[model samples]
Target: MTAPGSIEPTDLSPLAWRLLRIAAGYEQRAVERELDDILQAHISMLESGSRALSNRRRQTLLELYAAELSPEQVTAIVEHF
Candidate 1:
C-alpha cells in the first residue's frame, strides 16, 4: 500500500519531464538556451528517457518551469524524483 500524496513507482518515468516541458511551452532549443550546460541533443535524450538527470539539473528545471506549471503538476514532478 502507498501513502497518500506519494508518487507511485510508475510515475517516476522520464515522460513526466517531457510532458511538463511541453506544457510549459519550451522547445528543445529554448530549454538548451535556458540550461547552458545542456545541449538540445542532451535534452532530447533526457526526454526520451535515454539519459538521466543529476539532482542539480532537476532542480534547475523545476525552477525554470515553475511559473508555467500548475501547483499540482509541480508537486507531482517534485515527488517524482
Candidate 2:
C-alpha cells in the first residue's frame, strides 16, 4: 500500500494519510461505511483530498477502523511525519 507516487502535494495531509492508511490497509467496506457514520462527508472528502482530518479525528479513525496497530504504534508512525 506504499503508493507514495500516488500521493501528491495536494493529496492527503500527513494526518489524513495516517487515518486513511488504517482504512486502506483493511480494505473493509463495512468499516468505510461506519467511518461515514462518524464523520460528515468523511469518505468522499478524504478520497478527493477536499479534507484532512483533525488530530482527534485521526485517533477516532484508527479506533473505528480496528487497525492492527495500537495507540502507541499509531503515535510512533505519526511522529515520523
Candidate 3:
C-alpha cells in the first residue's frame, strides 16, 4: 500500500510521456479534455519524477485513455515507445 506522500505506480508511464509530447503541440484545453482535467504542469512534474501520481489521477487517466484512444493504439504506443 502507498504511504502518506508516497508516489503511486501510475506515475506517467513511457506511453504517457509519448502522448504528452504529442499533445504538447495542441492547445492546453484539448490535452486536459483528453487527460481528464489533469493539468499539464502536473504531468510535466510527474514525468520529471518530482511529483506523485495519485490513485484518483491514475483512475482518471485510465478512463480518459480508454474512452479516447483505442486499446490497440494504447498497446502499440506502450510497446513502441
Candidate 4:
C-alpha cells in the first residue's frame, strides 16, 4: 500500500541487517560456519560494496532470512547489487 513514488520495505538491502539480527539473537557460530557461505563479514563486504552476489545467492538470502520484502523490492535489489 505504498503510494506512488513512496519508499518500499525493500528500498535498501535489509537482508544483511535481518541476517545479523537473527544471528545475534540465535546462533552466530552456526551461521558463520557454512563453508563457502559468508557470514558477518559478508554483510560488511556488501555494505562496503566490496563484493557483488549472484541472483541465486540473493534469493537464497531472502529465503534464508525469511524477510518480507516485496517481489519488486527483491528484483530491484537483485538487479542493483
Q: Stretches of candidate 2 above 4 Å error? A: 1-24, 28-30, 36-41, 47-49, 52-59, 65-67
**TM-score for candidate 3, residues paired by index:** 0.53
Off by over 4 Å in 3: 1-15, 20-37
The alpha-carbon RMSD values of the candidates against the true structure, listed in the order shown, are: 4.9, 8.4, 7.5, 7.7
Report lDDT per candidate.
Answer: 0.68, 0.49, 0.53, 0.46
RMSD of 2: 8.4
* lDDT ranking of the models: 1, 3, 2, 4
Candidate 3 vs candidate 4: the TM-score winner is 3
Question: What digit string (tens of lDDT, one per residue) describes model 1 on residues 21-56?
Answer: 877899989998988887888778777889777766
TM-score of each: 0.70, 0.41, 0.53, 0.38
Please, what are the lDDT tens digits per residue for candidate 4 over residues 1-81? 333133332333645444433533434454456424757666455545576555455444445443345445534444453
Cα lDDT of model 2 overall?
0.49
Please give the TM-score that candidate 1 achieves against the real structure: 0.70
Assess candidate 3 and give its lDDT. 0.53
| Weakest ten-residue segment in model 3 by summed lDDT | 1-10
What are the clash counts of all predictions, listed in order? Answer: 0, 0, 0, 0
Instruction: Estimate the lDDT of model 1.
Output: 0.68
Best by TM-score: 1
Tens-place lDDT digits, model 3, residues 9-50: 364474465464453343435556667558877666655667
Tens digits of per-residue lDDT, candidate 2, 1-81, equal: 233322232333545554546534644454455665444456446545667656456555555543555555444444444
Task: Find the candidate with the highest lDDT and give its number.
Answer: 1
